[model samples]
Target: MTATLDQPTAVATGVVVRPWRAVLLRVEGQWTWYRRHWTASLLSSGLQPVLFLAAMGIGFGSQVRPGPLTGGMPYLAYVAPTILVSGLITIAVAEAGLPVLSGFKWKQDYWAVASSPVTPGQLFTAELVWITLRLVLGSVLYLVVTTLVGGWTSAGALLVAPIAILTGAACATPVMAFAATTKGDGHAFAAVNRFVVMPMTLFAGTFFPVDRLPVVVRPLAWISPLWHGNELARGVALGGLRLWPAVGHLAVLVGLLVFGLVLGRRCFRRRLVV
Candidate 1:
């Protein structure tokens, strides 16, 4: 290889050197924060999806066997992406919960960090970035678990790992935005999860196709960030991604992310100052 470099190589003192120190520092900080509360993290992300995967896919799979969802596929393969998306949503929900509450109430660490070198917007951005990082980790772990439990297919499902991260980030934008608006715990998160997150998770076609549900219920899936992410994940995992549909998934995801970020920044300013 003629000088392999994953990042920028600069000429320093007449020598070509890659400065990874900054990247390494950020990685260390992320890891430091992650390790402190990884157990609760795993409960929401990895285990939650795994449980659903088995309960519906294997347990109830016999009841729905040989259907379109099977798609001439094993029930496990067909359901894998949905599980991955649910895992992403679970991660998103976790991101929306305690961390937001802690930042506003228990810890107040975010305010302190914002007061220093970091601005409120930067603090929000950093936390969002951290959520994405967590999403990536949880997705990878879930994929591995699924694989070992016999969910891997075509080696393409391996690609679903990082896609889960993007899927997670897509929803995380909204989660963080929602978090940024809060003045107190005050059961705000409880309401968001009960009303918003729960409905999305249940009706969002994660376990089965939206068409299977009544027409009245299917529309909710269209509005859900997780549903779009699930569609994208299923397409990628099953190799069913067509141009228009793929573009549709991407468009919806990006739109949600943009909306979340823009609204979230405003919320950050409002909550942090006046």
Candidate 2:
């Protein structure tokens, strides 16, 4: 009897497949779910930011005259980019935090997904991609509204979307990692929102220059990813950021995002694979 050994079909055919294809399939599944509820998502991600701009940037800003802090521009112009970053961060935190916990605990969806060919790292990447899709959609809407409200000053303002997404990733990845490790219902997420996110939004130069803050507390804003985002967004929108400073801000955001991704991947593997 002559037994023939089977050849590796993929190598023989010269067809190499990427591992990230599985991650994209998972992202497609998330897109399907998002499509069904896109209206509600739009309300939260799109309309909410517009309302905030209307109320704070326009209505409240009307009373504040141009000043040194505002660089002789309307307060609306000064605060618009900051608000955009704020909205991105809020949405990012929500998408990454509780839903992540639900995936592991309430719904056990992570377990279900892991049972397939998809690895834990791919699942984490898919989650980040889903969150990024939401941020991009929301940010586009915000930019349209900001333009209508006279918030776009420089053409460079267009860079806000990608910068905001980067900022969101900086915040979301670490939060997702924490959520992956949670063993209970997501009570801790609420605390994080109330304590950490709230303070960051208030103090991260969203409403004013961080330098204007007390010297003792200025370091707090210095360490906030939101502050870095706000600085870049406002600088680009106002046509003031130098090339080297812009590169530095981008590097900081990228660094945080990378660190968080590493931590999130490890946590996801620990929670799902073991």
Candidate 3:
């Protein structure tokens, strides 16, 4: 017997579940794109962090004494985890930017996928997965440099790369999902950077402690995934974190991702529907 176009749909409704097809599409696209131009990819993800680490950690760290991050830990050690988080932040934010806009407007992949067997939820899943991969890749390079350059003080923090990526995606996915809702022109992401991310990057205990910020603003830092991630990552790097704090940080990351996924799926549905 021959199958018609609706046969796949009928079969799926009856008994079939595929969780990550959209995710595979994203990862596969990254693999293909990177294969064609590996150098630029590395430069953007790897080299960029290395330079930032050199200038920020090593260069400036010399003047500062072993401070709060170390409780005796060097300033460089104190700051490495934040840089690691920064790399992931960059990648996650990028996933929300041009590519998302292109998918909606230029490439119309969001529309194209809808005509296929994919659901908006699946697309959301795929995009989040892809963003996670990109963030992770960027993070690992930064971590390795932290180790090689002595910015990372202990072996424990070696595990922080995956943690950082998860946290970054927790933050970025919802932001991207929000971006997906734009009809045509969207500056929401730029606004996020200028108002949201940039503030988090500076005051969310990345360079200085969140305690240093004003009391009113300090409460807001609690809402930043980067701050939570940076704290966990730096503490782990310094061998300074308790188990409960680590779990708490991870929990926040999970919550953010869930929130983003739910909202992003809704946004995708609204934006793609003609």
lDDT of 2 by residue, 170-241 (tens): 889999999998887889999999988889988899888888889999998888899889989988889778
Full-model lDDT, candidate 2: 0.87
> Using TM-score as the measure, which candidate wins?
2
TM-score of 1: 0.83
Which 10-residue window in model 1 sums to the lowest lDDT? Answer: 15-24
Candidate 1 lDDT, tens digit per residue, 22-85? 3343446667976897775677646777777788777876576566656777787788888778
C-alpha lDDT of candidate 3 relative to the true structure: 0.76
Pairs that clash in candidate 3:
70-73
User: Best-fitting candidate, measured by lDDT?
Assistant: 2
Ranking by TM-score: 2, 3, 1
In order of lDDT, best first, we have 2, 3, 1
Pairs that collide, model 1 = none
TM-score for all models, in order of appearance: 0.83, 0.91, 0.87
